[model samples]
Target: MRRLLAICVGIFTATVAWAGMPNVTFPSIDGGTLDMADWSGRPVLVVNTASRCAFTDQYEALQDLYDTYRDAGLVVLAVPSNDFRQELGSAEEVREFCEMTYGIDMPMTDITAVTGAKAHPLYRHVKSETGFVPRWNFNKILFAPDGSVVDTWGSKTTPMSRPLRDAIEAALSGD
Candidate 1:
């Protein structure tokens, strides 16, 4: 009886398999959390976005990328930000614009800062570990299933670019 109880306790106490990354949660645009841990064991393409920038059109390709890879366990997360003074005035305007103009259905966060002292923990951690930060709106960060930074790119790197796609593919395949 003692051995059986110990075995059960050990099994219950075992850590999660996807324990590589720290817990990071974003305020969801849909009025809840967009927790990174929830998508553990999946690759996440996170883009710091804005509604009024020239690169705003990249939102379309982002949606397309998500549509293409979602079924394969890829998660595309849009993080709308006003750090560059280009995002819409509020989350409402941002959501309305993204849905009306781009028909985006991917997960999105409420307006959040992506750089500097007030930058979200996601950016801060990325910078500290990988020395990468959003140079401008639409910057992308690819996180592997283990929560490690797989790759990063600036505003000019479109979501559907070959290199970005390759990185996503590699991450998705656990390579």
Candidate 2:
């Protein structure tokens, strides 16, 4: 009986786990709603960023990638998560810093937890599916056009790395 119960629980857990990606609704930093569904059929590059983190310079590279790929079905969304330490200012402040410091014109979303007990819903999927996190800062998650996680890159991986750019190109091709 004990073995049977354990097997049943395992099967049930697997069923729930494989159901589908959870729908996530987050407020854009610009005070707008951004539903994950809207990004369907478009490859997405999600990054956890901070205004004061040492890796902040990646913003410029990220913006460059976005500018290059925006016409190719690539959407780079920066999510300012302060889960590590309070390294970012208000949403408005982040916007100003990104715009002035790096000239970042890509889409940016509200600051939220990317790890720990309070990790946001999208991050929960990112961490579980990709087995990675912001770790420090500037960790990236690349999702296919079908909303499936394709790959993850750490802070050490520059945004313009050949592998990343190629992945984005492949995802754009959706092939």
Candidate 3:
């Protein structure tokens, strides 16, 4: 009985430590705090974005996807990052440009770190779990409804890709 109790306790502690997804806190482009914990119970697409990158046009498609599926448990977050010397502006400027040009209504977070030694906690978790970083702007990380890492897509993968759609469907259906 003593051995069984100890084993159960160990399992419980490990589970608690590893349960759900890793937590992250970033700032909104407007200087407000953005907490990943608030996204609990929702599947999210975390994308590293830049204003001047070649793939910056993906923002339109991403916004389209978000508009299409957001009512169905999809939450797309655009995180502007200058990690690659791409976005060379302040958060407010990036937010204004994206909103004015693309009409992006999804969550627009501050310029979070996405690579090298200063990667944000979310990006660190993504790179460690998925074995890849945002090689360039517009890399996407899809979180499962249960907050686990579901898939990571490179810049080449369009927001409308079938695999992304299918993965999101699977995550939603599982909920």
Candidate 4:
């Protein structure tokens, strides 16, 4: 009976996780908080970024994507993480670097942990629900307007990649 109960609880947890996104907030690089709930009616593309990674150049593509689809309710959220040991020394530095180097205008978070026990609540929830973790910098997680996980891409997947764009298109169109 105890074993059965455990299995049932696990099922319930997974079901709840699949139903919606975790109520998580990020430490906005601009100060204060960036609540995920605020983007409820928009598709969000979350990318874990590192300033010094080889994939860092993808920031330009990410900005272009935001510029192109933002009017259609697409939100590109840049999460600066030093989990892979490549981010700048501080949030101020990260912000300055991103704005000056990449011309980024999208939302961004401070240098937060994106792996292990110290990972942000959103990352933890995603890992627990989908077993998806950022293996390296620039890992992307696409979320539907309803807050469900749409798809994910690894470090090499550019923001303008066909597959990722298709997923975003679907999410925006409510597919």
Model 4 segments more than 4 A misplaced = 1-22
Q: What RMSD does model 4 have?
A: 6.5
What is candidate 1's lDDT per residue for 53-118, written digit by digit as tens? 999999999999999999999999999999999988889989999999999999999999999999
lDDT of 4 at 47: 97
Give lDDT tens digits, candidate 3, residues 74-106: 889999999878895798889889989999989
lDDT for predicted candidate 3 compared with the true structure: 0.83
Off by over 4 Å in 2: 1-19
Error of 1 at 67 (Å): 0.4
Could you say which candidate leads in TM-score?
Answer: 1
lDDT of 2 by residue, 93-122 (tens): 898889989998888888878888888877
lDDT of 1: 0.90
Better of 3 and 4 by lDDT: 4
Worst 10 residues of 3 by lDDT: 14-23
- Please say which candidate is ahead in lDDT: 1 or 3: 1
- Backbone-clash count (model 2): 0
Name the lDDT value of residue 54 in candidate 2. Answer: 78
Give lDDT tens digits, candidate 4, residues 76-155.
99999999999989999999999999899999998899999999888888898799999999999999877778888999
Which of the predicted structures, 1 or 2, would earn the higher lDDT when compared with the native? 1
